[model samples]
Target: MGKLYVVGIGPGGFEHMTFKAKKAIEESDVIVGYTKYIDFIEPLIKDKEVLSTGMKSEVERAEKALELAKDKVVSIISTGDAGIYGMAGLILELKKDEEVEVIPGITASSSAASILGSPLMHDNCNISLSDLMTPYDLIKKRVELATQGDFIISLYNPRSHGRPHYLKECIDIIKKYRKGDTPIGVVKNALRDGQEVTLTTLENFDDTIVDMFSIVIIGNSGSYIKDGMFITPRGYKL
Candidate 1:
Protein backbone atom coordinates (compact mmCIF):
# COMPACT_ATOMS: atom_id res chain seq x y z
CA MET A 1 0.00 0.00 0.00
CA GLY A 2 1.15 3.54 -0.74
CA LYS A 3 0.94 6.59 1.57
CA LEU A 4 -1.57 9.40 1.96
CA TYR A 5 -0.86 12.86 3.33
CA VAL A 6 -3.69 15.31 3.95
CA VAL A 7 -2.37 18.85 3.94
CA GLY A 8 -3.79 22.21 4.98
CA ILE A 9 -2.57 25.04 2.73
CA GLY A 10 -3.61 27.83 5.10
CA PRO A 11 -6.00 30.32 3.57
CA GLY A 12 -4.36 30.23 0.14
CA GLY A 13 -1.19 32.00 1.23
CA PHE A 14 2.26 30.55 1.03
CA GLU A 15 3.36 32.47 4.12
CA HIS A 16 0.53 30.93 6.12
CA MET A 17 1.20 27.37 4.93
CA THR A 18 3.19 25.12 7.26
CA PHE A 19 6.57 23.68 6.24
CA LYS A 20 5.29 20.13 6.44
CA ALA A 21 2.22 20.93 4.35
CA LYS A 22 4.38 22.35 1.58
CA LYS A 23 6.73 19.38 1.82
CA ALA A 24 3.93 16.86 1.50
CA ILE A 25 2.56 18.60 -1.56
CA GLU A 26 6.00 18.84 -3.05
CA GLU A 27 6.73 15.14 -2.56
CA SER A 28 3.39 13.74 -3.53
CA ASP A 29 2.91 11.99 -6.87
CA VAL A 30 -0.71 13.14 -7.10
CA ILE A 31 -2.52 16.13 -5.59
CA VAL A 32 -6.29 16.27 -5.13
CA GLY A 33 -8.58 18.95 -3.74
CA TYR A 34 -11.36 21.39 -4.58
CA THR A 35 -10.87 23.40 -7.75
CA LYS A 36 -10.22 26.68 -5.99
CA TYR A 37 -8.03 25.07 -3.37
CA ILE A 38 -6.08 23.32 -6.13
CA ASP A 39 -5.51 26.70 -7.78
CA PHE A 40 -3.93 27.94 -4.56
CA ILE A 41 -1.20 25.30 -4.85
CA GLU A 42 -0.75 25.59 -8.60
CA PRO A 43 2.89 26.69 -8.51
CA LEU A 44 3.95 23.68 -6.42
CA ILE A 45 2.19 20.90 -8.31
CA LYS A 46 2.87 22.03 -11.86
CA ASP A 47 4.65 18.79 -12.69
CA LYS A 48 2.47 16.43 -10.68
CA GLU A 49 -0.85 14.85 -11.58
CA VAL A 50 -3.56 17.07 -10.16
CA LEU A 51 -7.22 16.06 -9.75
CA SER A 52 -9.87 18.50 -8.64
CA THR A 53 -13.65 18.72 -8.35
CA GLY A 54 -16.01 21.60 -7.83
CA MET A 55 -18.27 22.40 -4.86
CA LYS A 56 -20.24 19.69 -3.02
CA SER A 57 -17.99 16.95 -4.32
CA GLU A 58 -15.96 16.39 -1.19
CA VAL A 59 -16.74 12.68 -0.96
CA GLU A 60 -15.63 12.18 -4.53
CA ARG A 61 -12.36 14.01 -3.87
CA ALA A 62 -11.66 12.00 -0.73
CA GLU A 63 -12.39 8.69 -2.40
CA LYS A 64 -10.26 9.61 -5.40
CA ALA A 65 -7.39 10.56 -3.15
CA LEU A 66 -7.63 7.23 -1.34
CA GLU A 67 -7.76 5.35 -4.60
CA LEU A 68 -4.67 7.15 -5.87
CA ALA A 69 -2.90 6.46 -2.59
CA LYS A 70 -3.13 2.73 -3.14
CA ASP A 71 -0.02 2.76 -5.30
CA LYS A 72 1.23 6.34 -5.23
CA VAL A 73 1.94 8.98 -2.63
CA VAL A 74 -1.06 11.31 -2.70
CA SER A 75 -1.49 14.65 -1.01
CA ILE A 76 -5.03 15.94 -0.62
CA ILE A 77 -5.13 19.64 0.12
CA SER A 78 -7.68 21.50 2.19
CA THR A 79 -7.88 25.21 2.87
CA GLY A 80 -6.98 26.19 6.45
CA ASP A 81 -6.35 23.36 8.93
CA ALA A 82 -7.53 20.12 7.36
CA GLY A 83 -8.95 18.66 10.58
CA ILE A 84 -11.17 21.67 11.30
CA TYR A 85 -14.03 21.54 8.79
CA GLY A 86 -11.54 20.38 6.22
CA MET A 87 -11.03 17.13 4.31
CA ALA A 88 -8.92 15.33 6.93
CA GLY A 89 -11.87 13.80 8.76
CA LEU A 90 -13.53 12.43 5.64
CA ILE A 91 -10.27 11.06 4.27
CA LEU A 92 -9.49 9.26 7.51
CA GLU A 93 -13.04 7.96 7.92
CA LEU A 94 -12.88 6.28 4.52
CA LYS A 95 -9.32 5.13 4.80
CA LYS A 96 -9.67 3.62 8.24
CA ASP A 97 -7.03 0.99 9.09
CA GLU A 98 -4.67 2.63 6.61
CA GLU A 99 -1.75 4.90 7.38
CA VAL A 100 -2.38 8.58 6.85
CA GLU A 101 -0.62 11.71 8.07
CA VAL A 102 -2.34 15.06 8.58
CA ILE A 103 -0.20 18.17 8.33
CA PRO A 104 -1.64 21.22 10.05
CA GLY A 105 -1.68 24.86 8.88
CA ILE A 106 -2.98 28.22 10.05
CA THR A 107 -6.78 28.08 10.23
CA ALA A 108 -8.99 30.96 9.05
CA SER A 109 -10.15 31.71 12.59
CA SER A 110 -6.63 32.14 13.91
CA SER A 111 -5.53 33.97 10.77
CA ALA A 112 -8.47 36.35 10.91
CA ALA A 113 -8.07 36.74 14.67
CA SER A 114 -4.49 37.82 14.20
CA ILE A 115 -5.53 40.34 11.56
CA LEU A 116 -8.29 41.69 13.81
CA GLY A 117 -6.04 41.85 16.88
CA SER A 118 -6.77 39.54 19.89
CA PRO A 119 -10.44 38.75 19.65
CA LEU A 120 -9.67 35.11 20.47
CA MET A 121 -7.47 35.87 23.46
CA HIS A 122 -10.11 34.39 25.73
CA ASP A 123 -12.23 31.23 25.34
CA ASN A 124 -13.60 30.71 21.85
CA CYS A 125 -15.60 28.25 19.76
CA ASN A 126 -15.91 27.84 15.97
CA ILE A 127 -19.29 27.35 14.33
CA SER A 128 -20.00 27.09 10.62
CA LEU A 129 -23.32 28.48 9.45
CA SER A 130 -23.37 26.26 6.40
CA ASP A 131 -26.24 23.73 6.43
CA LEU A 132 -25.00 21.68 3.51
CA MET A 133 -24.33 18.67 5.72
CA THR A 134 -25.45 20.00 9.11
CA PRO A 135 -29.04 21.03 9.60
CA TYR A 136 -29.93 24.70 10.04
CA ASP A 137 -31.65 24.00 13.38
CA LEU A 138 -28.53 22.38 14.83
CA ILE A 139 -26.34 25.23 13.58
CA LYS A 140 -28.67 27.76 15.17
CA LYS A 141 -28.63 25.88 18.48
CA ARG A 142 -24.84 25.87 18.43
CA VAL A 143 -24.75 29.61 17.79
CA GLU A 144 -27.22 30.21 20.64
CA LEU A 145 -25.29 27.98 23.03
CA ALA A 146 -21.96 29.52 22.10
CA THR A 147 -23.32 33.02 22.60
CA GLN A 148 -24.88 32.15 25.97
CA GLY A 149 -21.60 30.69 27.16
CA ASP A 150 -19.93 34.04 26.37
CA PHE A 151 -17.36 32.36 24.17
CA ILE A 152 -15.73 34.32 21.39
CA ILE A 153 -17.46 32.75 18.39
CA SER A 154 -15.71 32.26 15.05
CA LEU A 155 -18.26 31.65 12.32
CA TYR A 156 -17.21 29.95 9.09
CA ASN A 157 -19.32 29.82 5.93
CA PRO A 158 -21.33 32.56 7.53
CA ARG A 159 -23.19 33.52 4.36
CA SER A 160 -23.58 32.41 0.78
CA HIS A 161 -25.74 33.10 -2.22
CA GLY A 162 -28.10 30.28 -1.32
CA ARG A 163 -28.36 30.99 2.45
CA PRO A 164 -28.22 34.76 2.50
CA HIS A 165 -30.34 35.13 5.62
CA TYR A 166 -28.52 32.62 7.83
CA LEU A 167 -25.96 35.04 9.21
CA LYS A 168 -28.62 37.56 10.11
CA GLU A 169 -30.56 34.87 11.93
CA CYS A 170 -27.47 33.83 13.85
CA ILE A 171 -26.69 37.43 14.74
CA ASP A 172 -30.26 37.82 15.99
CA ILE A 173 -29.79 34.76 18.20
CA ILE A 174 -26.56 36.23 19.58
CA LYS A 175 -28.22 39.59 20.18
CA LYS A 176 -30.69 37.91 22.53
CA TYR A 177 -27.86 36.72 24.79
CA ARG A 178 -25.25 39.44 24.30
CA LYS A 179 -25.39 43.18 23.97
CA GLY A 180 -26.08 44.69 20.58
CA ASP A 181 -22.83 46.59 20.85
CA THR A 182 -20.72 43.47 21.12
CA PRO A 183 -17.84 43.59 18.68
CA ILE A 184 -18.19 41.72 15.36
CA GLY A 185 -15.23 41.34 13.05
CA VAL A 186 -15.57 40.24 9.45
CA VAL A 187 -12.49 39.11 7.56
CA LYS A 188 -12.66 38.06 3.93
CA ASN A 189 -9.90 36.03 2.27
CA ALA A 190 -7.86 36.47 5.46
CA LEU A 191 -4.22 36.48 4.33
CA ARG A 192 -4.94 35.95 0.68
CA ASP A 193 -5.31 38.50 -2.08
CA GLY A 194 -8.02 41.15 -1.92
CA GLN A 195 -8.28 40.72 1.87
CA GLU A 196 -10.85 42.84 3.65
CA VAL A 197 -11.42 43.29 7.38
CA THR A 198 -14.41 45.09 8.81
CA LEU A 199 -15.01 45.68 12.52
CA THR A 200 -18.58 46.34 13.51
CA THR A 201 -21.09 45.45 16.22
CA LEU A 202 -23.86 42.90 16.44
CA GLU A 203 -26.41 45.65 15.89
CA ASN A 204 -24.56 47.15 12.95
CA PHE A 205 -23.57 43.91 11.22
CA ASP A 206 -24.51 43.80 7.53
CA ASP A 207 -24.78 40.21 6.44
CA THR A 208 -25.20 41.25 2.81
CA ILE A 209 -21.46 41.89 2.54
CA VAL A 210 -20.46 38.50 3.89
CA ASP A 211 -19.88 35.47 1.65
CA MET A 212 -18.48 31.92 1.68
CA PHE A 213 -14.92 33.29 1.77
CA SER A 214 -15.54 35.40 4.86
CA ILE A 215 -15.08 34.58 8.55
CA VAL A 216 -17.19 36.31 11.17
CA ILE A 217 -15.90 36.66 14.73
CA ILE A 218 -18.27 37.66 17.50
CA GLY A 219 -16.81 38.92 20.76
CA ASN A 220 -17.96 38.26 24.30
CA SER A 221 -19.39 40.80 26.74
CA GLY A 222 -15.94 41.80 27.93
CA SER A 223 -14.61 42.29 24.44
CA TYR A 224 -13.97 45.80 23.15
CA ILE A 225 -12.65 47.68 20.16
CA LYS A 226 -9.66 49.88 20.79
CA ASP A 227 -7.64 51.67 18.10
CA GLY A 228 -9.49 49.66 15.47
CA MET A 229 -8.53 46.36 17.10
CA PHE A 230 -11.02 43.84 18.45
CA ILE A 231 -9.85 42.68 21.87
CA THR A 232 -11.22 40.02 24.18
CA PRO A 233 -9.57 40.60 27.56
CA ARG A 234 -7.99 37.60 29.24
CA GLY A 235 -8.35 38.90 32.80
CA TYR A 236 -4.96 40.57 32.68
CA LYS A 237 -5.46 43.28 35.28
CA LEU A 238 -3.42 46.37 34.71
Candidate 2:
Protein backbone atom coordinates (compact mmCIF):
# COMPACT_ATOMS: atom_id res chain seq x y z
CA MET A 1 0.00 0.00 0.00
CA GLY A 2 1.26 3.52 -0.83
CA LYS A 3 1.44 6.33 1.76
CA LEU A 4 0.64 10.03 1.46
CA TYR A 5 2.37 12.74 3.45
CA VAL A 6 0.66 16.10 3.77
CA VAL A 7 3.61 18.30 4.67
CA GLY A 8 3.60 21.91 5.81
CA ILE A 9 6.59 23.86 4.51
CA GLY A 10 6.00 26.68 6.98
CA PRO A 11 5.91 30.34 6.03
CA GLY A 12 8.25 30.67 2.93
CA GLY A 13 11.77 30.18 4.27
CA PHE A 14 14.13 27.22 4.21
CA GLU A 15 14.95 27.63 7.88
CA HIS A 16 11.29 27.54 8.82
CA MET A 17 10.76 24.13 7.22
CA THR A 18 10.97 21.33 9.74
CA PHE A 19 13.50 18.49 9.54
CA LYS A 20 10.74 15.93 9.03
CA ALA A 21 9.29 17.94 6.14
CA LYS A 22 12.68 18.01 4.47
CA LYS A 23 13.22 14.29 4.92
CA ALA A 24 9.74 13.52 3.59
CA ILE A 25 10.29 15.57 0.46
CA GLU A 26 13.66 13.98 -0.08
CA GLU A 27 12.20 10.48 0.26
CA SER A 28 9.05 11.04 -1.71
CA ASP A 29 8.88 10.00 -5.31
CA VAL A 30 6.47 12.81 -6.22
CA ILE A 31 5.75 16.26 -4.81
CA VAL A 32 2.64 18.33 -5.42
CA GLY A 33 1.73 21.86 -4.46
CA TYR A 34 0.81 25.33 -5.70
CA THR A 35 3.33 26.84 -8.08
CA LYS A 36 4.62 29.48 -5.69
CA TYR A 37 4.93 27.03 -2.82
CA ILE A 38 6.62 24.53 -5.12
CA ASP A 39 9.11 27.18 -6.13
CA PHE A 40 9.85 27.84 -2.48
CA ILE A 41 10.94 24.22 -2.08
CA GLU A 42 12.38 23.58 -5.52
CA PRO A 43 15.96 23.33 -4.34
CA LEU A 44 15.08 20.54 -1.93
CA ILE A 45 13.26 18.47 -4.56
CA LYS A 46 16.35 17.71 -6.69
CA ASP A 47 15.30 15.24 -9.39
CA LYS A 48 11.90 14.37 -7.88
CA GLU A 49 8.90 14.68 -10.16
CA VAL A 50 6.83 17.73 -9.18
CA LEU A 51 3.26 18.62 -10.06
CA SER A 52 2.30 22.23 -9.55
CA THR A 53 -0.99 24.04 -10.15
CA GLY A 54 -2.20 27.61 -10.22
CA MET A 55 -4.43 29.31 -7.67
CA LYS A 56 -7.93 28.07 -6.69
CA SER A 57 -7.33 24.60 -8.10
CA GLU A 58 -6.99 23.02 -4.70
CA VAL A 59 -9.60 20.33 -5.22
CA GLU A 60 -8.12 19.32 -8.53
CA ARG A 61 -4.66 19.35 -7.07
CA ALA A 62 -5.70 17.19 -4.13
CA GLU A 63 -7.40 14.74 -6.44
CA LYS A 64 -4.37 14.47 -8.63
CA ALA A 65 -2.11 13.95 -5.64
CA LEU A 66 -4.34 11.19 -4.32
CA GLU A 67 -4.35 9.51 -7.70
CA LEU A 68 -0.58 9.64 -7.83
CA ALA A 69 -0.27 8.44 -4.23
CA LYS A 70 -2.22 5.30 -5.14
CA ASP A 71 0.82 4.14 -7.05
CA LYS A 72 3.78 6.00 -5.52
CA VAL A 73 4.94 7.79 -2.37
CA VAL A 74 3.59 11.31 -2.61
CA SER A 75 4.03 14.48 -0.59
CA ILE A 76 1.57 17.36 -0.83
CA ILE A 77 3.13 20.55 0.42
CA SER A 78 1.17 23.21 2.33
CA THR A 79 2.72 26.56 3.24
CA GLY A 80 1.73 26.71 6.88
CA ASP A 81 -0.02 24.51 9.43
CA ALA A 82 -1.73 21.94 7.25
CA GLY A 83 -4.99 22.28 9.18
CA ILE A 84 -5.21 26.06 8.92
CA TYR A 85 -6.93 26.82 5.63
CA GLY A 86 -4.36 24.50 4.07
CA MET A 87 -4.61 21.63 1.58
CA ALA A 88 -5.54 19.23 4.41
CA GLY A 89 -9.24 19.95 4.08
CA LEU A 90 -9.41 19.39 0.35
CA ILE A 91 -7.26 16.28 0.59
CA LEU A 92 -9.54 14.71 3.19
CA GLU A 93 -12.56 15.66 1.15
CA LEU A 94 -11.26 13.60 -1.76
CA LYS A 95 -9.32 10.91 0.08
CA LYS A 96 -10.62 7.34 0.38
CA ASP A 97 -9.04 4.01 1.12
CA GLU A 98 -5.67 5.63 1.56
CA GLU A 99 -3.20 5.91 4.45
CA VAL A 100 -2.59 9.63 4.94
CA GLU A 101 -0.29 11.32 7.44
CA VAL A 102 -0.33 15.05 8.22
CA ILE A 103 2.95 16.65 9.24
CA PRO A 104 2.33 20.02 10.93
CA GLY A 105 4.37 23.17 10.38
CA ILE A 106 4.38 26.70 11.81
CA THR A 107 1.37 28.60 10.58
CA ALA A 108 1.99 32.10 9.19
CA SER A 109 -0.59 33.59 11.54
CA SER A 110 1.15 32.17 14.61
CA SER A 111 4.59 33.09 13.34
CA ALA A 112 3.51 36.62 12.47
CA ALA A 113 1.60 36.98 15.72
CA SER A 114 4.66 35.88 17.69
CA ILE A 115 6.83 38.49 15.99
CA LEU A 116 4.25 41.14 16.98
CA GLY A 117 4.17 39.72 20.53
CA SER A 118 1.06 37.94 21.89
CA PRO A 119 -1.81 39.45 19.97
CA LEU A 120 -3.22 35.91 19.72
CA MET A 121 -2.70 34.91 23.34
CA HIS A 122 -6.33 35.47 24.31
CA ASP A 123 -9.61 34.45 22.71
CA ASN A 124 -9.17 34.83 18.97
CA CYS A 125 -10.47 33.68 15.63
CA ASN A 126 -9.08 33.50 12.11
CA ILE A 127 -10.91 34.78 9.07
CA SER A 128 -10.02 34.67 5.40
CA LEU A 129 -11.26 37.68 3.47
CA SER A 130 -11.12 35.87 0.16
CA ASP A 131 -14.68 35.13 -0.99
CA LEU A 132 -13.67 32.44 -3.42
CA MET A 133 -15.52 29.64 -1.64
CA THR A 134 -17.18 31.42 1.31
CA PRO A 135 -19.81 34.12 0.94
CA TYR A 136 -19.22 37.80 1.72
CA ASP A 137 -22.23 38.02 4.05
CA LEU A 138 -21.00 35.12 6.15
CA ILE A 139 -17.56 36.67 6.44
CA LYS A 140 -19.15 40.01 7.37
CA LYS A 141 -21.27 38.38 10.06
CA ARG A 142 -18.27 36.63 11.56
CA VAL A 143 -16.29 39.84 11.48
CA GLU A 144 -19.14 41.62 13.27
CA LEU A 145 -19.32 38.99 15.98
CA ALA A 146 -15.57 38.77 16.38
CA THR A 147 -15.33 42.52 16.69
CA GLN A 148 -18.21 42.75 19.19
CA GLY A 149 -16.83 39.91 21.28
CA ASP A 150 -13.49 41.67 21.39
CA PHE A 151 -11.69 38.64 19.97
CA ILE A 152 -8.32 39.11 18.30
CA ILE A 153 -8.49 38.40 14.61
CA SER A 154 -5.80 36.83 12.41
CA LEU A 155 -6.82 37.60 8.87
CA TYR A 156 -5.61 35.46 5.93
CA ASN A 157 -5.82 36.26 2.27
CA PRO A 158 -6.18 39.93 3.06
CA ARG A 159 -5.43 41.07 -0.45
CA SER A 160 -5.16 39.59 -3.94
CA HIS A 161 -5.40 41.00 -7.42
CA GLY A 162 -8.98 39.85 -7.99
CA ARG A 163 -10.20 40.96 -4.52
CA PRO A 164 -8.35 44.22 -4.12
CA HIS A 165 -10.93 45.90 -1.86
CA TYR A 166 -11.86 42.95 0.34
CA LEU A 167 -9.46 43.91 3.11
CA LYS A 168 -10.84 47.45 3.20
CA GLU A 169 -14.39 46.11 3.42
CA CYS A 170 -13.36 43.83 6.29
CA ILE A 171 -11.74 46.75 8.04
CA ASP A 172 -14.94 48.78 7.73
CA ILE A 173 -16.94 45.92 9.24
CA ILE A 174 -14.46 45.58 12.11
CA LYS A 175 -14.64 49.30 12.79
CA LYS A 176 -18.40 49.04 13.33
CA TYR A 177 -17.93 46.91 16.45
CA ARG A 178 -14.53 48.20 17.56
CA LYS A 179 -12.85 51.56 17.87
CA GLY A 180 -10.93 53.15 15.04
CA ASP A 181 -7.89 53.28 17.31
CA THR A 182 -7.73 49.52 17.64
CA PRO A 183 -4.25 48.23 16.86
CA ILE A 184 -3.54 46.33 13.66
CA GLY A 185 -0.35 44.74 12.38
CA VAL A 186 0.47 43.48 8.93
CA VAL A 187 3.23 40.89 8.47
CA LYS A 188 4.23 39.99 4.96
CA ASN A 189 6.35 36.99 3.98
CA ALA A 190 6.98 36.09 7.58
CA LEU A 191 10.38 34.41 8.10
CA ARG A 192 11.23 34.93 4.41
CA ASP A 193 13.71 37.32 2.95
CA GLY A 194 12.38 40.79 2.13
CA GLN A 195 9.77 40.37 4.85
CA GLU A 196 7.86 43.51 5.89
CA VAL A 197 5.97 44.27 9.07
CA THR A 198 3.66 47.24 9.47
CA LEU A 199 1.98 48.45 12.67
CA THR A 200 -1.09 50.61 12.29
CA THR A 201 -4.58 51.25 13.63
CA LEU A 202 -7.82 49.96 12.25
CA GLU A 203 -8.66 53.41 10.93
CA ASN A 204 -5.39 53.64 9.05
CA PHE A 205 -5.17 50.06 7.78
CA ASP A 206 -6.25 51.10 4.30
CA ASP A 207 -3.38 53.53 3.94
CA THR A 208 -0.79 50.89 4.90
CA ILE A 209 0.92 48.20 2.83
CA VAL A 210 -0.61 44.80 1.93
CA ASP A 211 -0.01 41.82 -0.33
CA MET A 212 -1.08 38.23 -0.96
CA PHE A 213 1.72 36.98 1.28
CA SER A 214 0.65 39.12 4.21
CA ILE A 215 -1.14 38.18 7.46
CA VAL A 216 -3.11 41.00 9.10
CA ILE A 217 -3.73 40.84 12.84
CA ILE A 218 -6.39 43.03 14.50
CA GLY A 219 -6.02 43.35 18.25
CA ASN A 220 -8.85 43.13 20.78
CA SER A 221 -10.24 45.87 23.01
CA GLY A 222 -7.57 45.49 25.69
CA SER A 223 -4.70 44.81 23.35
CA TYR A 224 -1.67 47.09 23.63
CA ILE A 225 1.82 47.61 22.27
CA LYS A 226 5.29 47.44 23.75
CA ASP A 227 8.57 47.89 21.93
CA GLY A 228 6.67 48.12 18.66
CA MET A 229 4.96 44.76 19.15
CA PHE A 230 1.17 44.46 19.49
CA ILE A 231 -0.02 42.34 22.42
CA THR A 232 -3.36 40.95 23.63
CA PRO A 233 -3.12 39.06 26.88
CA ARG A 234 -5.38 36.04 27.47
CA GLY A 235 -7.45 37.87 30.14
CA TYR A 236 -6.33 35.76 33.07
CA LYS A 237 -7.93 38.28 35.42
CA LEU A 238 -11.36 37.69 34.02
User: Any residue pairs clashing in model 1, and if so which?
Assistant: none
The sequence of per-residue lDDT tens digits that candidate 1 reaches over residues 83-146 is: 9999999998899555699999889999999999999999999999989889999999999998
What C-alpha lDDT values do all the predictions have?
0.92, 0.87
Off by over 4 Å in 2: 236-238
For model 2, how does the per-residue alpha-carbon lDDT over 104-210 read when each residue is reduced to its tens digit?
Answer: 89998888987787888888899998888899899888888888988899899888888888888888888887877788999988888788888888877762379
Measured against the true structure, the TM-scores of the candidates, in listed sequence, are 0.98, 0.94
lDDT of 2 at 112: 92
Segments of candidate 1 deviating more than 4 angstroms: none
Instruction: Tell me how many clashing residue pairs each candidate has.
Output: 0, 0
* Number of backbone clashes in candidate 2: 0
Tell me the TM-score of model 2: 0.94
> Residue 21 of candidate 2: its Cα lDDT?
87
